[model samples]
Target: MARRGHHVGVNDTDPPLPAGTPLPPDELGHRLTEVFDLVGPLYRRALRKVEQGEAVEGASVGVRSVLDLLCRKGDLTVPQLSRIQALSRQFVQRMVNDAAAHGWVEVLPNPAHQRSSLIRITEEGRTLIATVLDREHSLNREVGGDLTDAEVRACVRVLREMLRTFDHVDVDD
Candidate 1:
C-alpha cells in the first residue's frame, strides 16, 4: 500500500482552471514550485527503481546515462557527451571509465581531438541498454490513466519551459 503523501500517480491538489484563466505571476510561480517539488522526489524514486532491477543491478544511473547517450548518438568525445548531458567533464569521464571497465563501452582515438578520445558503445552495452529500455517501456505501459496525446504533449511543453527557465543557472560539479 502507498503511504500518505506518497501518491503513486497524479494528485489533484488544485482544481482545474478555466481554459483561459488569467494566472497571476505569483500564482504561476507557486504552481511551478509545486511541480519542481514533485520532480525531485520522482527522479530519485525512478533511479532507485531502475537500480533495483535485476537486469541492471550493477549499472549506476550515471553509467547507464552515458551508455544510453553513446548508443543513441554513436561515438562521441567525453567533452561532447559532457556538454550534451550538461554534466561536468570529470563526472562524465568517470562514468565512461566505469562503462569501459564493465566491457560496455570502448574508448577510441579521435581524429579531430588528439586529447579527447571518442567513446563507443560495445555490442554488450547495446544489449544491456535494450533490456533496460524494454523493461522501462513495459512499466510505462502500466500507467493506466487513459491519458491523451494532447495532454502528454502539454505536460512536455510545461516541463520544457521549466527547464528553459533554469538553463542559465550553473551547477556544474
Candidate 2:
C-alpha cells in the first residue's frame, strides 16, 4: 500500500503546491483521513511480510509498540499507556485486553490506585516482542536506507509537531 505508486512523471518532478493553496481545513481533514485509509492496509501488509515465516498472531504496529513500551518500562497503567500513545484510554484498554487474552500481558493489582491496575508483559510477550523488534529494526533499516538522514529527521520533526497539536484541532461534531 505504501509502495509509492508510480505517478509516471510526477513522483519527483511535480512542483509543490503553491503557497498554501493545496488544502483548506476541511479538505486537509479529508485528505488526512484518506491517508490513514490508505496507510493502514499497507502498513499491516508490511508487518505481515516481516512476520511471514513466523507464527506471530495479532501483531499490528500499534500492538507491537505497546509491547515494546511494556518491555522497556516494566509495567504501566492503561491510562499511562494511552497518554503515551495519544490514543483513547478505552482504545488502549481494548488492546490490553486483547493482549491479555493471548497471554502476552497481565493485569495486576496496583497499590498506587485501586481504580487503576498495572499491566505487565509476560515472558511469552517478551519473546514475541523480541522477534517483532528484530523484524521492525530490519524493516526500518531497509526502508530508511533509501532516504537521507536529513530527510528522515525532517519527517520526524514534522510528525512530532503534528502530534503535539493533534488533540487541539477543533472538531465540528
Candidate 3:
C-alpha cells in the first residue's frame, strides 16, 4: 500500500474553476498549468533519454545536482552533501555510491573521522560536468536568449528571493 501523499503519475482530472471568474495572474491554477506545460514534456524527454543511456555519467537529476554542488564547492563528506543539498543522508550516500562506482567521484579517507569519507570529483567527472554544463548553457540561452545577462541574473535573484520567502511561510490551519 502506498503511503499518504505518495501517489505517482499524473492526475488527469481537472479542478472546477469559479464561475465567470477572471483568474488572477499568480493563481495556483495558472502556475500549475504553466509548470505542467513546461516541465511535463521536459521530464518525459529527459527520462526517455536517460533510459536510452544518451546521458550516461549523470543518469539522474539527483545525481547531477550532487555533482554540480561538488563542482562548485569541491570535496564534501556525505553529511555535508546532505546538508547542502537538503537531501536525506541515505539519498546522498546512494548518489555517492553510484558516482564512485562509475569513476565519476573518488572517496578519500576523512582524516578527522575514521568512519566518514570525503568525496571529490574525478577527472572523468569534471569532463562529464563540462559537457553537461555546456549543454545546459545552450538550453538556457535558447529559453532566455531575449533577456540581457543582467536581466537574467536579476530574474534569478528575484526568483531565489521568492523561494526563500516561501520557505519561511508557515502553513495556516
Candidate 4:
C-alpha cells in the first residue's frame, strides 16, 4: 500500500512547508471535481423542477420578460411588447403563441391599429407568477436561513460582478 504523507496538521505552531513542495496539477483537478460535485447538482435539480412542471414561470428569459412586461404594463401590441422586452419580433411572437396555449396571455383587437393586436396577461398568468415568486422566496429563505438579508444582497452583488466577464477581453500571457 502507498503511504500518504500530505496530512498537514491544523495547528498554527507547525512551520509552513518549504517553498519547493510541488503541487501536482492532478490535485488541483481533484479540488475542481469536488467543487463541481457540490454545485452541479443544485443546477440539475433546478432543471428537474422545470421538467416536473414546477417551473411555470416559462422556460426562457424571452418568455418571462414578455409576461413581466404585460403584467406590469397592462396591455401592449406585438411590436410594443417586443420593443419593451428587447426581444426580436419573431422570438416575441413565438413566446406569445406559447403563452397563449398556457393561458398565460391572450391577444385582443387593437383599436389603435387596423391590423396589429394587443397582448395582455390572463388572470391565471398573474396567479402563476405570484405563486412562482412565493415559492422562489420560500426556497431562498429555507436554503439561506443562516444568512442575513444584507449578506444575501452582498453575495448577489459579488456573484454578478464575477459573472460580468467580457468576451472581447483577451488574456495575454
Q: How much is 109 displaced in model 2, in angstroms? A: 1.9
Which candidate ranks first by lDDT, i.e. highest? 1
Q: Cα lDDT of all candidates, in order?
A: 0.82, 0.73, 0.69, 0.65
Error of 1 at 76 (Å): 2.0
lDDT (10s digit) by residue, model 2, range 1-173: 22222223323344545863644565445445555566689768876675563455556555676788999999999988987877778778888987898899999999999999999999999988998877677877766457887887966764575567676643322
C-alpha lDDT (0 to 100) for residue 11 of candidate 3 = 29
Among all windows of 10 consecutive residues in model 2, the one with the lowest summed lDDT is 1-10
Off by over 4 Å in 1: 1-22, 54-57
Residue 72, candidate 1: Cα error in Å is: 1.7
Q: What value does the lDDT take at residue 121 in candidate 2?
A: 98
**Model 2 TM-score, all chains together:** 0.63
RMSD of each: 5.8, 6.9, 9.8, 10.0
**Deviation in Å, model 2, residue 63 alpha carbon:** 3.2
Better of 1 and 4 by TM-score: 1
Which residue ranges in model 4 land beyond 4 Å of their true spot?
1-61, 139-173
Better of 2 and 3 by TM-score: 2
Question: Could you say which candidate leads in TM-score?
Answer: 1
Q: Clash number for model 2?
A: 0
Question: Candidate 1 versus the native: TM-score?
Answer: 0.82
Tens digits of per-residue lDDT, candidate 3, 76-168, equal 899888876667788889998988887889999999888889899988888777777676676556674477888768657655654565554
